[model samples]
Structures are given as C-alpha cells and as structure tokens.
Target: MRTFNMHEAKTNLSKLIDETVNGGQPFVIAKAGKPLVKVVRIETEAEKPRRRIGFMKGQLKVPADFDTMGADEIADMFEGKSK
Candidate 1:
C-alpha cells in the first residue's frame, strides 16, 4: 500500500490509478498524515466466486412438505410460527 495526500490524489488521479492497476497495489489517502480511505482495483468478471467447501453438500435435507406447503404456511414457517 502507498499513502498519498488528498491534494496529490486529486492532482494526479490518472497517474495514481495507473500505478495502482499496473502494479496491483493499493493506495491510502490521508488528511494531515492520518489515514482516511483506500483505493484498489475492481475484480474482473472472470474471477471465480469463492465458495465454502461442503457448505451444503450433505447438510441440506429438504422436508417432504417443502413443495406442498401453501404461501401462508410458508410465511408462517418463516415467521417462526412453525418449528
């Protein structure tokens, strides 16, 4: 990470963005030497989304009544009226 004052960031916004993107580096903008904010690259679409392994592999067990329940019953279930 690099630190830059607000004035420098504003005056050289393009250069700062270029530096950040080219080097995969982040920047922290500060006011009076106190850290304020960070600037970083955005994730590209090709980046695969992370998932928790076995998060639902064997943990999910849908009830037989899952599809048979009416809207009101589903709402009541969500509202804690049904256990």
Candidate 2:
C-alpha cells in the first residue's frame, strides 16, 4: 500500500489508478494527513477462478442413514415441540 496526500493524489489520479489496476498495487489518498480512501482493482468475473465440480470427490463421508438422520428432530421442531 502507498499513501499520497490530497495534492499528489489529484495530480496523479490517472497514473495511480493505472498502477493499482494493472500493477496490482494499492494506494491511499489522505486528507489533513489522515487516510481517506483506497484505490484498488475491481476484479471482473472472468478474472475470478471458477470452482470445479467433483474437485473434492471422496473427501467427505456420508452415513447410510443420512437422509433420515435429522428428519425426526426437524419435524418435532416444526410441530412446536420443545426439548
């Protein structure tokens, strides 16, 4: 991260933005010597990685009674039963 005062920030707005987006560098604009805002790249969907299906196959385990394991408890909760 880089810090720039208001005057410098205004003078180099375009360059700062370019550096932030292309060079993957971030910068902070300050007012009264206090940090104000940050400049950063907004990643588009295409730039993001897609999660592949079956990527975690066999990494998890399932019990034979998975479907019915929580059915009774859920029904009781819905029927106003408190335990």
User: Whole-model Cα lDDT per candidate?
Assistant: 0.87, 0.89
What local lDDT does model 1 show for residue 32? Answer: 96
Clashing pairs in 2: none
Task: Please list the residue runs of candidate 2 whose C-alpha ends up more than 4 Å from where it truly belongs after superposition.
Answer: 47-83
The TM-score of predicted model 2 comes to 0.52
lDDT tens readout by residue for model 1, 1-83: 78999999999989999988887589999999999999998867786879878777777887888877687877898899975
lDDT of 2 at 18: 84
lDDT of 1 at 43: 65
User: Tell me, what's the RMSD of every candidate?
Assistant: 11.6, 10.4
Instruction: List runs of model 1 lying over 4 Å from the truth.
Output: 47-83
Residue lDDT tens for model 2, 28-76: 9999999999888887776677889999899999899988998888999
Point to the candidate with the largest TM-score: 2
Candidate 2 lDDT score relative to the true structure: 0.89
